[model samples]
Target chain A: MHKHLLLGVEAIGQGAIDGGMSGVYAYPGTPSTEITEYIQENELAIERQLHSKWSANEKTAYETALGMSYAGKRTMACMKHVGLNVAADAFINSAITGVNGGFVLTVADDPSMHSSQNEQDSRYYGQFAMIPVLEPSNQQEAYDMAREGFALSEETGVPVMLRITTRLAHSRAGVEYKPVLDENQLSMPQDPRQFVLLPAIARRRYKSLLDKQASFVKLSEASKYNQYTDAADKSMGIVCCGISYNYLMENYPDEACPYPVLKISQYPLPEKQLKKMEAECDSILVLEEGYPLVEEQLKGYFAGGTPIKGRLDGTLPRDGELNPDLVAKALGKETYVGIQVPSVVANRPPALCQGCGHQDAYEAMNEVLADYGKGRVFSDIGCYTLGALPPYETINSCVDMGASITMAKGAADAGLIPAVAVIGDSTFAHSGITGLLDAVNEKSNITVVISDNESVSMTGGQDSSAYGKIESICEGLGVDPAHIHVIVPLKKNHAELVKLFREELEYEGVSVIIPRRECIQRASRRKRNISRHANH
Target chain B: MKSNIILAGVGGQGILSIAAALGTAALENNLYLKQAETHGMSQRGGAVVSHMRISDKPIASDLIQMGTADLILSVEPMESLRYLPFLSAKGYLVTNTTPFVNIPNYPEYEKVMEEIHKLPRFIAIDADRIAKEAGNARASNMVMLGAASPFIDIDFAKLEDGIREVFARKGEQIVEINLKAIRAGRQFSEENK
Candidate 1:
């Protein structure tokens, strides 16, 4: 079985380099940025140097993969599901401080917001951090749940996640390779304050993570990737979860499904194959890919019993992502529609790239905010959030990931004196320097800009913990090195970037500007990697 | 015996290197593939596609459902009418009559070639003037994967050993200029379809 193909995030970066992951904290984001860029271009993870770099974001890639699972070994953090909401406070307190070596995390959701903003369902943050979550119905169960999600997070010690989506993290298939283990060494954690939580040791490590949630629901009721099967039309049993079980066997291409499927790629909801397919069929449906986290936990909150369908009883899409002709029109079948997008087809969308220094810093910040009125700019997440479309609608807030300097410092503390914030140069080094040090400790009346472009050009060019350190991180966050300027977002540096955005939008207090350059697709991929290393 | 394709263009139109040489000729035809692709923020230049498939067995939804694409291929020209609802009314678009026109109400090219001549299984070549007469005008997506190699079912020497193993690490004159741009896109789709 020497298959290869890969890409469910490079089969969890080759199942964390053949399962004994030595390191890989992440931050590039898209579909969990190619699982740390396929273990930073693996050649046995760069001859075992491992620790794939690029963090400064998802909470410093989940506290540096929980400090390399607290000095024991095995790692893996990954992101994209709003980079697990900036690594949800050390991912829900690293599940009440558990692990010593094996920690996995992973994430990747983006159900319908293709390149994400929300269709979030990191299995309800893996059941609100109660843990054990896996979810991989394809790419060989995303390479055997990332090669046994670190021995299921070290025989149920904690931190496991895995999740996946955005069509099982940007598809492709095959996979194969398995047996390769060996990396644990440095061992420790035998309770010396297991991981000092400090609230009386996090209430005894949160009741041993609630007494290991009944051994993670009896290892998801004997999971061999949670199956069940049994087909003979017991009305509707189905259930799915994770690549929505490959859009339900792509509507059963002779995998012959009358009913009774279960599937649920490992999760605590396996309660004995979800109570034998909710007592053998007669009406269940489910199919989760993003929300309706197991049909809102089997419709718990009254007015429901077995008649449970998915995306909150709308039978199917109460939102997005899910294909096989929307599961063959929600299984009633009858697909085949096709032709008719033609009125000479139109709407293409995603622009900013004809030599894009964010299109000369959004055409000099839309001609210096055409007399600053229509909601002063805001923007954040990379590719300069396509300058909020149109021939530069000049960003009136593209929202999350360093919400453009604390939403332009809460509209410049409500007074809105020329409120700006543009962002990106690795989202102002992810989370934009704590909203520019809370607008330079309240010298507010903002301007900011920082478009930099040095890299992380929207999840591809990568490297940019705000390159060449955004003018000494805006002069060490205090901002007034003569109101920190810098220019070069060229179309011949658009009149010195419109005189540094009209003298940093008529600075009253905190002003930045920046603009800089580099990402013209990361300067032609660093001139095609320095001419393919000067032709070897 | 299945293909499903889609591919399309725009986002740095390399169409994921024609889906990594049709996923390495569907893994040397041991078959069963999937594909999908379209990384981050609509891949900044946007309007991407991918989908792909291949089969002989075991394949389940890496998308490619709505109307069941049997091949769209694209590389531009209204990104092949935006995946005409995933083709298959006995599909086969192919595309690339040049025209990426990076947005700006870009519609009429004789009304997008009169809506790809109302597709009765289209072709529409140009492919950057046959990959600049096959000398490698960036191997025009391997000349639109060689004008979509006689509508894919694999083996045109396993797509030149899948572009000689995905351009054998950018050497050998870039795999002989992407196998002479997929043989000038399979001799202009065998003398124009």
Candidate 2:
């Protein structure tokens, strides 16, 4: 088996490949963007004929995966934890309609507002949909769970939710590989009543969903991923799920802890494993990230439920996330006094990279918008958004993907002069297109600068969805051809770019400025790829 | 046994590279390792941090609580100070003294250095200068790794091997430079000791 320093979202892609999946669909976002990007990068995945591409939005991505599933092909849909809120319609109904082919929804949750507006847990969504949710503790389990998750979905005829967190999605871990599984040549569901959500058929499918719960629970109990280690100390039994198990062991590393430890990596609350832990220990600690759902489930298992501890009992924090120090506190262990080395240095804030196209774009935009003062520039997520800092101070708002256009439209409608929206090419495709369409349809006066960097340089260098079609997208969206200006943002063209930028700002209708340049980092990656190909 | 480390630096400065090498070394030493990172917001040149916990058993969360990190491996002095709250009292801090002005802050270099000198348990080196002298300025992370080697349980040679494994896949030139850089760091730490 080979190993990889796979990121969390990349693990989902790896999982999909291992599970014999045919297609992977997603729109780029933090924590979830890497899934499709990885598949595109991996040679093995391409040779396997994996269908991995960025969709227009979460809804489009979800529907694409569903369509693939309907064709009797295994599929995986991925998005950020918050993006699920946008795709919830299809997500909820997919469970109600049941599944003909194996399918998995991989959502990467971000707690602490890390590149997100909020830290909402996606696990609750799975519970609401009444689908089995499986979370892996490490990259190995992440891969294994993905492989098994498909089978579980097939066995139950229900779509599965594999929820990952920022840590898992962004972190790299050593993942062992196995021989790729062969694809199943299965037939699509021909029974029209199975998918038709007419009330009569919907009621039958809902009953079938409930009827399958017992077997699903049984399968979860027998899942190889849910394990129990009889480090049984009747004094205290700890049941940890996903990455929490890693923390529990990290908190008490020196000793085996005179207690039983139940490691739950699968969902539906492995009752068999919980019962075994409860039988051995006096108090059980539910060490799962996000919610106390497992704790609540454990409470129902006991006659009065053997006193359970977790977020509810304040053993773990009610909100945010859990780490080693918190786990140590939960176990009542002496402080895990980490290394006591001292720093011989100071603190520094972040800045733009030298020779970055974003730097030039920000500078040109700032030069043109200097008269507008600060807080007038609306921006989306990308390297260019760093313009919000001093020196340039070009962008003011950065809410999420593709918010610049909508935000600029709103501000311009409110009479904010020279309303400017700056977004990257990848982000424009991710969610900015609709905002642009809204601006065009409403004839909102806004100037949008689409920084076409040829690649998504933020989460490593991945191909941008609008790699070669920025101009066409703008033209197709009814942007005035004369108002739409294209310029290669360089120091030499600074004056021209700034001039065009000003003209677009002065335009009454929606104007698009396409700042085209290859991201320097992506240029290096392409060089590496060419050299590799030459050597081969 | 449970030791949490917070390693911070600018993006593209090999922040993840250091964490990966450290994690591999710990894993090789039979320690259970969970190295978590944030790939969010740190678009290219933005600040980046990786949380690594090494223990003899499994771990739950990969996050390092505020003011609880045992070791802070900072490639840049300012980035190190940014993560000071994550460090435990008397926690070891190893960072390069070379000033890397990320934000357009006008604080004088000497003033920043003076402020860092006020902190507890600090070891400052001109890691960037040293790495540059060693012929690869990008090897500043290895210089910090040199300062951090003695405190952790993993062997220096193990870290050297991990570094080799990482860069080998990139190219022979990178492999050679990284190995030499790691050795230079190890030797520099030894000289100070």
Whole-model Cα lDDT per candidate? 0.82, 0.79
Per-residue lDDT, model 1, residue B74, is 86
In order, what DockQ does each candidate have? Answer: 0.31, 0.34
Q: What tens digits encode model 1's per-residue C-alpha lDDT throughout A346-427?
A: 7777877787777888888788788876777788877777778787788887768888888888987988878888887787
Query: Would candidate 1 be rated incorrect, acceptable, medium or high by CAPRI criteria?
Result: acceptable
Quickly count the clashes in candidate 1: 0
Predicted candidate 2 versus true structure: per-residue lDDT over B1-193, tens digit per residue:
7777888877767777788778777766677676777675664556788888787755555677666777888887667767766778767877777755656543667765775677667778878777887778887787788778876777778988888876777777777777777777767666764
Residue-wise C-alpha lDDT for candidate 2, range A373-419, written one tens digit per residue? 76788898777777777667777888877889999999989998779
